[model samples]
Target: MILVIGGTGTTGRIVAAKLAERGHPTRIASRHPSTEGVRFDWYDPTTHPDALRDVRAIYAIPPVGEVDPAPIMLPFLERARSAGVRRVVLLSSSAIGPAGHGLGMVHARLGELFVQWAVLRPSWFMENFVGEQPHAVSAREQGEIVSATGTARVGFVDPADIAEVAVRALTDPTPHNTDHLITGPEALSYDEIAAVLSEVSGRPVKHRAIDPVGLAARHTANGIPPDFARFLASLDTAIAAGAEDRTTSTVADVTGRTPRTFRDFCRDRLRGDRPG
Candidate 1:
């Protein structure tokens, strides 16, 4: 059985669904399951064993909003190894590296912990513009998207593409003991993205750039922890410094199809469902 951690999340749900579609006996693990799944919590170690039962491969998503997930994840991973889990596909981010903070620490040690391992360092998600995140909320309510990334470009990929790659990593016969840098076809600036959003939805959307400190403060006001907010702000600051100004073909190479653009993603979402 393939175990999908964070199975109800943005990418995890798609990964679980794709695994099932491919005839894999998939097990969904969540902190609060809405369906027939195991209750798995990162802070609760006792739940680990039951979730790992009969599971051979795992699609691992580190605890959300965590600054450092390696310490919490390592013990569970060790137990997974002891429980006979062989393959592990960890979802990481392009901004963080093997030696960087957060899930990067998990990426640093993923290879030696399992027989088959892959670290997916996907770029920013386009879903952020339509989901419950601050970007989406602001766009829907205020007709603007705020960020610290001033005039910077990003290759925002769809979560479905990321999920497809995750499925391949989990089920592929060979151990792809390497990191995959996933991204969409083109890099686009926030201003460009806002213009596209305006065109697609026929709304007057705009990009509002602010300082990193201000962005962090806004995130904190939205109930995000101070440190996590600062971390997110730092990512935006990095983007402003041209950190995410490139694109990659990983999605097409892995999935045999071109990754969707921001316009396509927006068009699909706005076709029937109006933004709240």
Candidate 2:
């Protein structure tokens, strides 16, 4: 049996569906129980056993924008290991540094567990177009996508590819305990993204580059905590300094297919004329 934490989420949902399609008995972990499968919550340790019971493989998706995910992830991972789970896949960010110091802590521990593991270090998700990215919404609604990343290019990856690779990692043992840097077909600046939006969505979407302090103020005004807003601004500065422009063939190397292009993503998700 395979257990997927954050199963209701974008990547987790796709992973669970793919696993089930391949005849794997899949369990979904969420706070709310559902008819699809067993529901479990990561925040509450009491729910771990019921979710991990009889599971042989696991997919771990830690909460996003989290500076400290260890407290929740480590305990759940240890529990899964004790339950005899042998294979695991972790959804990590590409923003994690070279030494993998911060979030790498979790991957390091998973490495010590002797399980067949694959850490997916994916770039910015294309899902931002359709999901919680307020910049995209602001563009569609108000004719502008604002960011602090001035002239920075990002290899924005599609979540579907991430899901496909994750499923293969869980089912196949070849790429055991390795890190895969997943990215899209090309790197694109936010300005280019805005242009794409303008073309696809049939609206004049513009990219507005704000200073870091100004961006922080906007984020705080949008209800993000001040500390997190400042942190986000700092990340933008790093990106502006060319931190995330690198591209890789690892996605195709692992999944035997090229990653989707941002144009394709925009065509599929944003081409429709839906009012946001």
TM-score (all chains, Cα) for each model:
0.97, 0.93
Which candidate has the top score in lDDT? 1
User: Which portions of model 2 show Cα errors greater than 4 Å?
Assistant: 98-101, 274-276
- RMSD over all Cα atoms, model 1: 1.4
Q: Please give the distance, in angstroms, between residue 190's alpha carbon in candidate 2 and its true position after superposition.
A: 0.7
Q: Candidate 2 lDDT, tens digit per residue, 1-276?
A: 999988888899999999989999999887665787676766777888888889999898986666667776887788788889988899987876324445678877778874588898899888887645777668767898888899999999999999998999898857467888889989999999888888888888888999999999998998888887897898788889998898899889888999999889888887556556
lDDT for each residue of candidate 1 in 72-141, tens digit (9 for 90 to 100): 9999999999999999999999998898455877898888888799999999999998867778778878
